[model samples]
Target: MESWELGEWYGEFLDALNRHDLEAVRSLIDPGVRRAHLPRGGEAWIADLGEFFHAFPDWRWKRIQLVIEDDRIAAHLRGSGTHSGHYRDIAPTRRHVNVAEFAIYRVTNGRIAEFSGSSDAELRAQLA
Candidate 1:
């Protein structure tokens, strides 16, 4: 896909996520999508994301920029939320956080086929 097309596609995917629409998210990702650091596929991703939203409730991601090349798109994003519930062993502190995140996604057949990125350490630090 052209860079602009990929950008629009990615924007729609992010819109689904920000809306917390798991069904839409599922439709946007391949069933066999590969996760670079996770053990399983798209289902695992959906579950993990659900847990994150449970913790933050109002978490939102804003796209800062995108770099597209061939079938891959690199995204620079800013995510922000209030800690209103449990996350792992951390209890809610009612603290709000905004952190930068970098992610790369590989698209295949117009859907996300692979993903690799993290904001774990930075997110943890801010929540602490």
Candidate 2:
């Protein structure tokens, strides 16, 4: 896809994600999308989000920037939400938090094929 088209595609996916629409999110991903750096499939990706969204009921992802290079899309984003549910072994703080993140996503055939991301150092300290 062209850079502009790919950006639009990601925008739509993010919109669906913000709305917490699982079906819409699924529509934008490949059936075999990789999770983390593992070989797991799209369901794993979806399940991971399920956990994240559960922890942050009002989770919001705002795209700060998007750069399309070849088949990869790099994104700079900010996320904020109230930690009101279980996250891993950490009990809910019920406290609002914000974090910045950067991610590189590979798209194949108009669907996300692979993704890797990192959050700001402050996120770790804040969560701790």
Candidate 3:
């Protein structure tokens, strides 16, 4: 896909995330998508994303920027939500939190096939 198309695809993906539409998110990701950062080390990227949203029902993902080059897209996301549910091994605290994340996605056929992300751990700690 062209760079513009990749940007659009990522935009929609972020929109779906902001809306907390699981189905839309599922539809946009490839079944074989891999997540490089997970408590369990590595797992399906979608599964990790689901875990995040499940833990924070009100989670909002805002795309600060999107850069597409070759077949990879880098997304800078700023998000905030309340910790009302369990996240991975993080127990429920019902605390409000804000996090900034940077993610790099490898796209193929207009779908996200692989991803790596990191967030501000200090922010999470502060909120918790």
Candidate 4:
């Protein structure tokens, strides 16, 4: 895909996520998607996203920048959310937190086939 298309695609993906539409998010992800810090494949990643949304129902991501190289796209993002639900072992603090996140994703056949990037540690720390 062209660079502009990749940006649009990622924008849509983030839109779906911010809307908490897991099914829409899943539709854009390859079933065999590979993830660096989580269990491999889309289902596992989708499940993780589900948990994240539950913890931060008002979560939103703001794109800071994107660098595209062929099928790989790296994104720098600012994510913010309200801690209104349990996250891992931490109880909800009702705190609103903002965190920086960077992620790299490989697109194949117009779908996200692989990805890896930021962890929840930063957000968790803020909540703590």
Best candidate (score: TM-score): 4
Summarize candidate 1's per-residue lDDT along 1-128 as a digit string, tens digits.
Answer: 88899999999999999999988999888888888868567888888888889999999999998999999999999999999999878999899999999999999988889999985899889888
Q: Compose the digit string of candidate 4's lDDT tens values, residues 16-94.
A: 9989999999999999999996798889989989988898999999999999999999999999999899888989999
Residue 116 alpha-carbon offset, candidate 2, angstroms: 0.8
Q: Which ten residues in a row have the lowest lDDT in candidate 1?
A: 36-45
The superposed Cα distance between candidate 4 and the true structure at residue 68, in angstroms, equals 0.6
lDDT of 3 by residue, 66-123 (tens): 8889899998888899888777667888888877889998988767778888955755
RMSD of 4: 0.8
Per-residue lDDT of model 2, residues 77-119, tens digit only:
9989988998777789888889988988999998898888884
Off by over 4 Å in 4: none
Which residue pairs clash in candidate 2? none
- Per-residue error for 1 in candidate 1, Å, reads 2.1
What local lDDT score does residue 119 receive in model 2, on the 0 to 100 scale? Answer: 41
Cα TM-score per model: 0.95, 0.91, 0.84, 0.96
Flag regions of model 1 displaced more than 4 Å: none
Q: Which candidate is the best by lDDT?
A: 4
For candidate 2, the clash count comes to 0
Candidate 3 positional error at 33, Å:
1.4
Per-prediction backbone clash count? 0, 0, 0, 0
Name model 2 segments beyond 4 Å from true: 119-124
